[model samples]
Target: MAGFDLVVRGGTVITASDRGRYDIGVQDGRIAALGLDLEPGTREIDAESLWVLPGGIDSHVHLDQPQPPGIVQADDFLTGTRAAAAGGNTTVMPFVAQIKGESLRQAVTAYHAKAAGKCYVDVSFHLIISDPTATVLGQELPALVHDGYTSFKVFMTYDDLVLNDRELLEVMEVARREQALMMVHAEGYDSIKFLTERLERSGKTAPYFHAESRPDIVEREATHRAISHGELLDTPLMIVHVSSRAAMEQIRWAQARGLKVYAETCPQYIALTAKDLEGLNMEGARYVCSPPPRDEDSQKAIWEGIEQGVFSTFSSDHAPYFYEGSEGKQNPKARTSFRWVPNGIPGVQTRLPILFSEGVSKGRISPETFVALTSTNHARMYGLYPRKGTIAIGADADLALWDPLREETITQSKMLHGSDYTPYEGMRVKGWPVTTIVRGQVVFADGELKGEPGFGQHLARELSPYAKPGRPS
Candidate 1:
C-alpha cells in the first residue's frame, strides 16, 4: 500500500516568504510533508517546470444575494465557485447581508440555505451589518463571531444600507469587544448624491459621468473618515476596493500613524481606466462599478501600493450582473440614467490572470509578492491563515499549478462564470493556472471542472490577522 494518498512532484513550490523545488505529499485533504525526495504515493502529478502556489483566496466576492426585482446576479455559489476554481482560487469568502428589521442570525441561516450544496470550493461569510441594533450588537454579533463569522462590513453610502457615524462607532465598539475585523466600503454617499444631482441637472448622465459623480476626493474623504473612526475606538479597519491615488494616500497616512488600517485593491483599478466607461452608447454601463476605475495615474498608484505593501490583499470584488435585458444593466431605470444601474463588475475568474500577467510578468511585482497578495495575505487578514493559505505541513492542500509562459487572449466563451461579457475580453495574458487543487482533490484540471457543486464546505473564521500584537484574543 502507498504511504500517502498523493504526491505532487518536481515542481517549484512558491510562497510569500520562500520558493524552491519540493515534492509535496498529501493525505486525507491535508499536506503531510514536503521534501526533496518523498516516499511514493498512490497518485502522482508531474509538475516539472511548473509553479506550484497556494490557491488564491478571494476574500471579497458576491454570490446569491437578494437584489432588486429586475436585477439578478448571473453567478451563484455553484457557478461563482466553479469560476473561482478554474481561475486557481481554492477558497472564496462572500458577504452575508443582514436586511433591516431582521435577525442577524436569521440572515446568516438564510444565506447558509442559499450556499447549501452549491459551492465548488471552500467558502466563508463576512456579515454586512445593515441593521446594527442593540440586540445584534450585544448578543447576536458576539455569538456569530464566536461561531467563526469573525468579520463584518459596513457602508457609509447607499440609501438603504449606509450607516451614520454614530451607528458606525457603535458597531466598531462591538468589533473591538468581540475581536472581529471591520471592512468598510469607503465612499461618501452624500457627496455622491450631491454630485449626481448636479450632474443630472446639467444633463451629464452618460456612463462616463458616473466617474465624475464619485471622484477621487469622495473616496479619499470617506477613507480618511473611516480611518479616523478606527483611530478613535482603537479598532483595526480594512478599506476595500480602493480605486484612486487619493484613497491609497489616505490608507498610507493611517499606516504611517501606526494605526492598523489595512487596504485591498482590485484588478479594475490596476488594469482598466475610466475611459472604459466611455464605451459607445450604453455599453459603458458594463464597467459601472462603484468607486469606478480611474486614470493612468491612479493605475500607477495601485501598482505602487502593491509593491510598497500598502495593500495587504488583492481581491476580485466579483459582483456579477448580466449586461443586457430589463433585469440587468439595461433595467428601465438604468436606461434613463446611469444612477439606476447596479454598481459591480465580474472578475472572479480573471483576477489572477490579470494580476499575474500585468504584475508578475511585466516585472511590476515578484512571484513572492503575487502569492502574498492573492493568497497568503488574504487568508491571514480574513482569519483563514496557516490552514488554507500556505504550502506547509498540516495545511489544507489547496494549491494552483501554473504555466507562467502560457499565453492566451481572454474571451467570454472560454470562461466558466455566468457573466455574459468579460471586461478583459481580447486582452492577452501571459500566465495561467492550469490546474487547481482543493484539499487533496483536483477541482479544476487543464481548463475543466472536475469537482461537483457540493464539494466545498463552509469555513468559520477567527479574529483579524492584522490585530495588534498582544491584543486580547
Candidate 2:
C-alpha cells in the first residue's frame, strides 16, 4: 500500500529552484515528499507531458467595488472566485473599498460580510483608503494593520479618489508605522483634467480621444511623484497598472538608487495599444482605462521589463463591469465625454493563459520565473508566504496541472468572469490548466468546478512589507 494519500507523477515540476521531472506525494493536505520510485499512495494522478506549478495567487481583484455615479460592480464573491479557480488560481486578494466619509472599520466589516463563507478558494483583501481622515489615519488604520489588513491602494487621478500630497503623506506615515505595503495608481490628476477640458473644447470627445486626454507624460510624472513621496517619508511604494515605457523607466531609475520602489504591469499595456480604440466604436469604451495602452515601442519595453527582472509581482487588477447595462461602458451617457466610461476590463480569468502563451511558449521568460511572479514573489512581498503560495512541506496543497499540449482559442463564451466580452478574444493559447487543487480538495478538473461555493476562507494578515512597522491603519 502507498504511504501517501495522493501522488502526482510524469510531470515537469517547476518550482523556484531546480526544474525536472519529479513526482510529488501529498498526505493530509501537505506536500509530504518529493522523490522517485519509493512510495505508493491511495490516489494517483498521471501528469504525463504536463507542467505542474503552484496555483496562482492574484493580489489585485475587485469583487464588489463601489464606483462613480453610484454604480456597483457586476461580479460578487462567488462569481469572481469561480473565475479565479478556472484560471488555475487557488488564492486571490481583492480590495475592500472605503466609501467616502465612512469609517474604515465599518467598510471592512461590510466587505467581510460579503466575502465570508462565499468562496471556492482562499481569499484576502487590500483596503482602498478613499476616506483617510485624521481620525482614520490615527485610529482605524493602525488597528486594522495589526488585525491582518496589511496592504492598501490609493488613487492619484480620479476626482473623488485623488489624494493631494499632504493626504498622501499622512497615509504613507500610517503605512510606515504599520509596516504595510502601499500601492499607488499613478497618474497626474490636474494634468488629466486640463487635457480633458482642452479635448472637449476641441470636439475631441470620441472614445479614441480618451487616450489622448492622459498622455504618457502625465503617468510618468505621477510615477515619479509617488516614488519621491515614498522616498521623502522613507516608505516603500508600488506603482500599479503601469502602462507606458516612461512610467516604467521612473520606477527602474528609483529602484536603481536603492529606493524601495516597485512596479507592476498588466496585459493591456503589453498586448493592446491606442490604435485598438481608434475606430471609435461605442464598444471601445470598454478599453478606456487610466494610463491607456501605448505604442509598439512601449510594448517592447514592457516585454523586456519582464525578462530583465523589473517587476516583482503580476496581478489581474480585475474590475468587472457589465456591457449594455445602465452603468456599463458600452452605452455611454455622455457620448463625447471620456470620463463617463468604465475604467477597467475583465482580466482575472485570462492573465495566466496570456502569460503562458507570450512568455513561456515564446521563451521570453523561463517557466520558473513565471511561477515566481504569479505566485512566490507575491506571497513573499505580501506576508502570505508558506501557507498560500507554494508546493512545499507544510504549505497548503494548492496546485495546478497544466497541459502544455492542450491548445485553445480564447473566447468570452467559455470564460467564467461576469463580463460580456473578452479583451483577448480569439488569441491562441498553447497550454491550459487541466486540474486544480486547493487545500487537498479538487476545485476544478477537466473544465468543471468540483468544489462548492462556500469552501473558501477569509485570510487575515498579521504584518505586511507594505505596512509601517507597528502602526495599525
Q: Which candidate has the highest lDDT of all?
A: 1
* lDDT score of residue 326 within candidate 2: 68
Per-candidate TM-scores read 0.98, 0.95
Quote the RMSD, in angstroms, for model 2: 2.6
Give the alpha carbon lDDT tens digit for every residue of 346-456 in model 1. Answer: 999999999999999999899999999999998899889899899999999999999999998999997888888888889999999999999989999977889989999
lDDT for residue 306 in candidate 2, whole number 0-100: 84
What is the TM-score (0 to 1) of candidate 2?
A: 0.95
> What's the CA error at residue 285 for candidate 1, in Å?
0.7
Clashes of each: 0, 20
Q: Taking the tens digit of each residue's C-alpha lDDT, what string does model 2 give over 1-473?
A: 77988888777888766577888888888888887763887988888788889999998888987777745576889889999999999999999888889999999999988887779988988898888898889989888888988899999988778889889988998888778899999999999999989998998887788899889999999999998888888898878888888988998898788788877888778778988767545757767777787799989988877887778887887888776666677544646577777777788888888887788888888888889888887888788887877777778788988987778998988788777777778888877888888877789988888999889888787675544332112
Model 2 ranges off by over 4 Å: 331-336, 465-473
* Runs with alpha carbons beyond 4 Å of true place in candidate 1: 468-473
